[model samples]
Target: MLDPKTGLPPRFLRTPDAARFLGISIRTLEKHRTYGTGPTYRKIGGRIVYTLDDLQGWTENGVRRSTSDETPCRVFPARPLTPAEKATL
Candidate 1:
């Protein structure tokens, strides 16, 4: 659904506001999205949107008591190599 006032998604935050909520710059957020490390997002009407809950939950993924604490970030697997592909490598 669209917001009657701004015509934007009503419940989710845009990139800028979501970035502010996370205390990060828009570019960083964009990079996260590119690298599959950012908070969960929805592609509504072909536009990106982030819910408050998802943002908060993903943020908690990095929570730790000490600076050295290890928190895993999302990662994607590389494409599988075929028999011929393996020969090239």
Candidate 2:
């Protein structure tokens, strides 16, 4: 089957590439993963990967026609970022 993203066969995308595809920063994507708010991912041979289908599915969760539209979301960390983690930013 043709991959809707690149017109090639479907393939797993690494974090950086997947972040680019989703138009978000790698750090933001990482935060989503940390908070369990990101796309489903696979850990293969110790490397994190995302399938196009999963990314697309996750994207659909955020679809909104207006700012007033409410779609349940949990994209932020439960607690504020620690000083140490903030230093890395």
For candidate 2, write residues 1-89 as lDDT tens digits: 56677899658899998999989899888878876778899999999999999999888877789977765653345245679955654
In Å, residue 20's CA in model 2 sits off its true spot by 0.5
lDDT of 1 at 81: 43
Candidate 2 ranges with C-alpha deviation above 4 Å: 1-7, 73-89
Highest lDDT: give the candidate number.
2
**Consecutive 10-residue window with the lowest summed lDDT within model 2:** 71-80
Query: TM-score winner among the candidates?
Result: 2
lDDT score for residue 20 of model 1: 92
lDDT of 1 by residue, 3-79 (tens): 89998865889899898988888888887887576788999999899998999998777667887765554322223
Clash count, predicted structure 2: 0
True-structure lDDT of candidate 1: 0.75
Q: Scored by Cα lDDT, where does model 2 land?
A: 0.80
